[model samples]
Target: MLRLILILFLCGLLASCQYQRPEDARVQIQEIEGQARFTIDGQVHEIKGLAGHTHLQEAHSIGANTIRTYDTTGLQSILDSAHHFGLKVVAGIWLPKSHVPWLYKNEEQRVKLSKELAVLGRKYRDHPALLSWCLGNELIFYDLMDFDFSSTYNRLLDSLRSGDPEHPVGTAFANYGHKAILNFALKIRSLDYLIINTFGRLPKLSEDMNDLDFLWSKPFLIGEFGENGPWETEWTKWGAPLEPSSSQKAEITGRRFKELPREHPNFLGALFFNWGWRHEQTDTWFNVFSKDGERSALYYALAKQYGDSPVPEIPKIKNLKIDHGTNANDFWFESNQWHEAQLEIPESLNQDSLEIRWSIRTEDWFFLKADSPPPLPDLIEYASDRQKIRFKTPGKAGPFRLYVSIHDRSGHFAAANLPFYVVQ
Candidate 1:
């Protein structure tokens, strides 16, 4: 009787231990043939990712295997969605700027920040779709000339690391501030990788990497990059840049995509500037999709670069003008007059479920400043098998632009714009 009781007690203890096993697992990053790559659940993953919020289905359709978000809000839903689509995420935690010296100096603020990171780590560390923890976006960009937050930043990273050891932790810096970034990175001792957000200066990135490599031998990824930014493009007298046309942005994206993987061996992956619209300097600046969720020309361009299959080209708008104007591209129109605008599509497009959308709106120059949002463009018409647009000009006299986007069922699109004046 004594021997039987001992055997039963041991069996119950073993069952309890098996039931309490941890469900969460950590992802791995390994060096292969002198290059660093990610391993999701022990399988190597090549990251083709986009930044910002996009519909899960649309994001998956474009060959994006990953997405990067800049905040932890609604993170469970985001993680669940990514897991459903077999996508991974470089989750971000927003860090307060170092411009406020008091925040970093105060013990209360330090504890608060550390606790926030701890909560995040405990909540999401075990998620199957998590790639890494990106602590902040360009936190050191503005502080480079003023102060150093290495101690604060490092402490926060340490807090997260303590709570979660399965994933890596890193932060993003702007293209400039190399010296300050290097100084802080060297002091941390726990940083796993480097993420840099750059724009026009990307051409010289390879040289900069060699410089950084001399001091710290670490892997890096381009956190955010688009064809151009307002600061990088040509500016007008009022200190605003004349944004490049959608077609120009598309062309640049194609060329940049082809060059990223081939540029540097340490270049693990890149996240395109934006997946959705935000009113940064201009409503149309870096957004890949319009306010109403129509894919931009850049979307299709990226699709062609990302997918192995051939993609259909977006329709071209050769000229836009008031009816029978002497100039091929005359955009001036009388407000009271009815005019027909013509579009010339390229014969090269192999049409499959082709559709077009047109819209007209007042110029958005007044609300183009940072943090101010411009009004969403009012859509005019949705059409099928249409090559011409007929409409009366806006009654109120102001600058306006006519936009036309052509799309196909295969998830490809083309976009163009014509700026015009409506005279009283």
Candidate 2:
């Protein structure tokens, strides 16, 4: 009798200790009536989200169902926070550009990195918030026909798969041509999908995809899309890119969102280029939010598209003009010269409820090599006013941009910048 009781207790203990899979743990792509759709645990799911780590709750509130990251830094916390907010995560794994020869040649380093990635996969595969694994972000394939690099990448993919077969794996590419697509089709057999990061070229994406269907036909995501990139915009006499004002950016956002192939059979979804502040060509280039966490016109534009009801009013900057200049971009300033600037806002907006701030920073002109953001430049101290202001240019001769941020009482703001060259 005693032995039988002990056996029963052990059986009960074993039953309780058995691992149970989390709900919706398996994510994959399925062809339903010739349409490739993403399915989470056999239920079709569409990704509507942005590509940044901050503002998870806001993203959820604005009707975003997913969040995309560029790398695994602080990933465990991000995944947990996302789950808490009922948002899914497309976890990105960082990879070096293909032009780097040493990474492919060094077998030991490759094996180490592969093992680390596999460990990450195994560790997070069961996390309920995980949607899929994006193997890399905007990695350029210099020689798609190179067998050695293909083999190395495949080994990495194999490592990830071995650790977690429940999730799908894909990679992000900068909008590439047919040769790269053909190479992906021929060599990268393990990839479940593709992610293309396009900016100015987004309008023609449908045409581009249709043209390349003969080479590759897998479902793809717009990994990054937003306003026109600095590389594709008009340049000033001093070669500075003319950045659009916040209101203009909102207009562009709406237009680009409309151009997305949401109705296409193979279109998965898109993650807007950025959801948080970033210093790229300019501090405000792709950032939807301000440094102080104020929502900009771009954010409101996206919020409306994502189903935010009763969207708040966006502050407008009719135009920012320098002294005696017809257009903001046509101005040049002398070193340390005081200039009066005029900011035009509609009379409908209550001027008393708005807070205006200004700053001057050196233009980020680096194009090829990636570098850290330059130090913050001096801020312009202005007396309380909304329409006119006086400020001095930098004391040295170089390219600089004057930035203005107007915040309303309702947590909405507008941003605009004007580029000027300082002459001695």
Candidate 3:
């Protein structure tokens, strides 16, 4: 009885010393998963600034349970926080020397380097926050090595497996032609997933994974992607400045329409390329959001799509006809001359929950107001941000302000003021 009492006291002491991280401020991988509705292998945007814990939390909020670090400095904090938040981490050991197929000419040097990576594996292997060990980032840049990477990958996997049997191991292959890609695949052990960097041929991304040509293999991810480098025809890639805004929408939306399906069975996860704004190189242009956070519609599209959504987002609004509410792109109604001047709602937002916000400013720039309470429109779900809103005044013909703001039941809203000329 005395021994039992002492044991209970010891148990209490251990429990008391256990760490408790903030609820909203995430801690480790296991913690955040409790709140996550689905697993998201999201790209981390500003992962460099604060310690890895802070960066990992930001990724968690956006529905990611895993992140691939660009480097190894803040790894421990990231790993710790990720574990608490139910977030997993892909530690990127980018040994640029690894890129050169024969950088380490001597067998002794190669052995030493292999040992270096093994040391890394040994250090973090048992941590609760680990997801996979990405042997190296873009090392196989179609690299011609005297000592093939297959020997090294198999070796590294052996090394990591020695330390941690709990997780899987992988290596990132830089962009490659289908034939070369397939050859590489043949060499390595089938991984939990494959990482392919195919930027120019995105539609082909799905096709590449499908194996319409070669015999099928395990699941894969577009570990790195964007429209073609500036070299590719402007005619071919999505839009302007590589259409950074539109490209994200096109990439993810296309993936959703084409490849996003939990039912697909083999698909596991994906880690998009570098998170921060890296403009030192003119060729790399896949960043979705800017350093300042001026997000494109695609950002919201991903948010709404992953969080919860009733329907796919409609194509972007374009070439609007002001008076008739009609457009080369849409048939929305627009009018003048009293209540009749109101624009008709587009059928796209019809029957869907949405929120749209837009505004019009006269040459003089005073916003109009709606005489009555706003109605929910099919186009926009929620509108906020601009200080100015447009609505129709009590009379349609008074030449009064025509500030119109509409919020549909779906929650989408658009408010804009247009300068006048009565209907033709």
Candidate 4:
């Protein structure tokens, strides 16, 4: 019995001694040929990334090396999946919302935030897939005073650094126009990089950065850049933004990616705005994929830009509007109203095996706040390469969007959506 006990103790001691805790394995920025490039594991790593949650396999298959999340929720899965695909992660930590006017001055809030960040750091700091710590997403969008903003950010930065000293800290801003905020960000010694999330301004990103050359100090990355946002568009008196078509969005996003590297040499990398579906002003406004998991034109456009070999030759929607309007905007319909949608597919595609599907559902703006159930599409005819389809609108009086997708037997597909109001 004494010999058995001694043998078990020896085995346990050996196991404990052999185990090594993972340490900081973060990416660093290196100046290469007058251009800022990412260096990981002593090798120059150029970041080709996507923002938001999606199938990591798809992201990696499309040549993206990194992915960013808006928050740390379900982060273990994200990190695990990213590692499986040889992808890195820009882990996000959400900050207090603007509704908490005195969050900066509240000691309790600060302590709570620090504790949470410490826990996250301890849990993830050693992971091989971690690229950097993104402190927050557009944290300055709130109405906080200068002192509060600076102090709060400093506190969070301190906590992050304390927990993980090797990885650099980053925070995303809505834009770079706020001089006071920009200057304050420069004052934070702990901050290593500044991430900017932009939509329409992406095309002129290099010019904008050049304008800030005198004030810019740290390396930067395009944290989010994609289609034109509804918030930037002209809105009616009813508070609905006039959104652009999906095709127009694809064109703009494709151009943004093409122009980024050429125009901004100092820029480290970019993460395409969104990879998963989410509720914004319009359900289809910013996401590259639909709620039903259908890939939009922007997806293919990005795949091509990212050098996806044998990139799928997906069809493009020439026009998807209600009642065959003069254009693809200002569409309105009544509840229970019968409407005919006209879809114009490109004439160059093989029509024989082209599988087409159309659907309609309630506008998904509510999906942004919480994990409410995904809106289900109303029944519409499914046919092969149909140009026109008729369906009855839902009785519920609210906003809705009409979606269509065309798929080929080769597993390549294209999609588009239009938002319209359902009146009483």
Candidate 5:
């Protein structure tokens, strides 16, 4: 039994020592000098894909200097597109769902994942376009939302610091900064920043931004904030929406303008809830992009806050069909530069192709061979050919989405989205 205990101790030490990062390597927080403002590197973005999803161009057009990607899969393309547009990307990978009922069988798996979590921080610690590393998104739903604010939270933050010393490390709370997140922040105090998400339900939402310092005595960010759901400001409660009037949207949304950085001292910047388009149960609210490629009021509001970069109207497409399946000829790029994507018809053009009217800048997600070497599509001018179809792409803050609306050769029509991410 003594020998077993010793073995376990050794294992623990080995895990802890494996991958460690210094904690001081965090993003520079602009301490208020005189104007009560720190140097603003970039305005943070929420990627806007929460409801449905939006094209990266919309986020870019609104002048987002940074975009938030929730997990590994959600991040790759987001970072890729944001970087292309000279934007920074925030990668938020969860530490394995803590509240996943019946999921890990024992405590050992939890610690093991934590050790691995440290390794993740180290791995991406040096990426140039990486803005921040988020611990988890709305994680505390764990203990009836009371969330044990003690050791568990500390371990997550420590793992992040140990692995990634530079760049702010934090999590986005669905609710305001209360005990759930405070439990972790007050104790660590080292938390580079805190993030808060608020909907219309919260009281004095904008005014509350200033009080963050009073609550934790540390810094904080307005992570997510938007109007009430169904999203139309005029939206009536459940089962009663005939879509609120645009006037209602403009009114309630205008309130956010009051929260803008015209006066706040403690507030850093606000990251709106989403960048893409989404529809929720008869109520379509929050999304800044539309399925037809239209922009939303919030996106414009943001443009005014920062600088505006209007998106060129996306052209339409015809006769485009993407072969649906998870692992088809998938090719991936993980660099931090502007990139264009143009995939070609595989000799296996067995998949549909060629079109009419015009093709919007999106393409089918072809899963390419893992070993298909260079002439690789890393540059703005590089080209690749296969099958009969050809794809040409440019590097920019893409994470660009394309819709292939096909008008049948015989005169029929259909459309689909091609999804891809560029990693920086």
Candidate 6:
């Protein structure tokens, strides 16, 4: 009896020491009842997420269940923080774009990257907060047509799969055009799902997906969507894209979220374009938050759509005009000439608690090149009278934009910019 008891105790100890994968840690896509749905372990999950890594706690508070990153930098910390906030992470694994042909051609380099990715897959595969692995973000599809590039990409995907079979792997493409669809259909069969980043084209995304169903019918996520990107909007005669006011952006964001095809059989839900601060075109073009961590009108819009209880009221900015004219498309000013601009806000907002600031920045024209963001233009000072400002145009003969930022005491902000050309 003593021997039997000792044996039973030993068996229990061994069982306790045995390694077991965490429950509900596996993430994948399944076709249940002819509909593709993302599943955690065996339970279906709809991804209401943000394609950024900051403000995770705030994101969770606003009903965002997932956060997507663009690279693995600080991934462990991001995963930890996300877990702390009960948020899942769609961790991104950055890959060299097709622009770097030499990297793809060098078999040694390609092998090294694959090995590194495999290690990463093994390292974080079991994290409870991990939802999926995104291989790349908006890689140039035109260059991906090269055999070397396509093979390299597929090999990397295979490497990731070898290390983690429990999680799904995918890539993000920009604006799903026919060429992109055809290329993906023929060369990229390894992805568990596809991620498409659409801005102005978001409303028609469902139509495009249906029309190209024969070419590619896999599940997809709207990896990024928001207001029209700078590249997709109307430009001034001198070529500066007209950015919408904060109020307009909020409206657009709400409209786009509502237009998402949540009922589509292959839809896996959408992730808003930006959840944190980004200096893409202007400092405010894509950022939903300010540099000081203040929430913008975009944030309130998302919060309301995300079903935040008691959503905070968004401050309003209306009737922004330059030199008493509402049309910026035909506006041009002499170099160094003073011009007046005005905007009105709701009288309900207390003026004493609001801080209004203004400036002018050179229009960002370097979109095609992957370079450092253009230096912020010199502070063209303005005399402010509440919501009205008088500022002199820049002395240069190029496109410039006047900007206004209004901050309320409650940590909310409103921003607007008007594009104009300065002539010699």
Clash statistics: count for each candidate? 0, 0, 64, 0, 49, 0
lDDT of each: 0.68, 0.79, 0.43, 0.70, 0.47, 0.79
Q: Quote the positional error of residue 125 for candidate 2 in Å.
A: 1.2
Among these predictions, the greatest TM-score belongs to: 6
lDDT of 4 by residue, 184-224 (tens): 43434356777888877776666666776765555788888
User: 305-406, model 2: which lDDT tens digit per residue?
Assistant: 887656666688888877846364567878888887778878888888888877677777874334324534543546667567777887889888777778
Report the Cα RMSD per candidate.
13.0, 12.0, 18.7, 12.6, 16.8, 11.8
Task: Tell how far residue 268 is off in model 6, in angstroms.
Answer: 0.4
| Model 5 per-residue lDDT tens digits across residues 114-222 | 6887887787777666777667777663342322333455666777678877767767676564545444433333556666666664446445444554545434556
Question: Candidate 6: worst 10 consecutive residues by lDDT?
Answer: 13-22
Q: Candidate 2 vs candidate 5: which has greater TM-score?
A: 2
Model 6 segments beyond 4 Å from truth? 1-25, 143-145, 367-384
Cα error, residue 274 of model 1, in Å, equals 1.6
**Which rank order by lDDT, best down to worst?**
6, 2, 4, 1, 5, 3
Scored against the true structure, residue 402 in model 3 reaches a CA lDDT of 32
How well does model 4 score by local distance difference test?
Answer: 0.70
The alpha-carbon deviation from the true structure for residue 74 of candidate 1, after best TM-score superposition, in angstroms, is 0.8
User: Alpha-carbon error at 237 in model 6, in Å?
Assistant: 1.4
Once fitted onto the true fold, the runs of candidate 4 whose alpha carbons sit more than 4 angstroms away are 1-26, 98-102, 141-144, 234-239, 242-248, 261-265, 313-315, 328-339, 348-355, 359-386, 391-401, 407-413, 419-424
**How far is 397's C-alpha from truth in model 4 (Å)?**
7.7
lDDT of 2 at 310: 66
Q: How much lDDT does candidate 3 score?
A: 0.43
Candidate 6 local lDDT, residue 388: 78
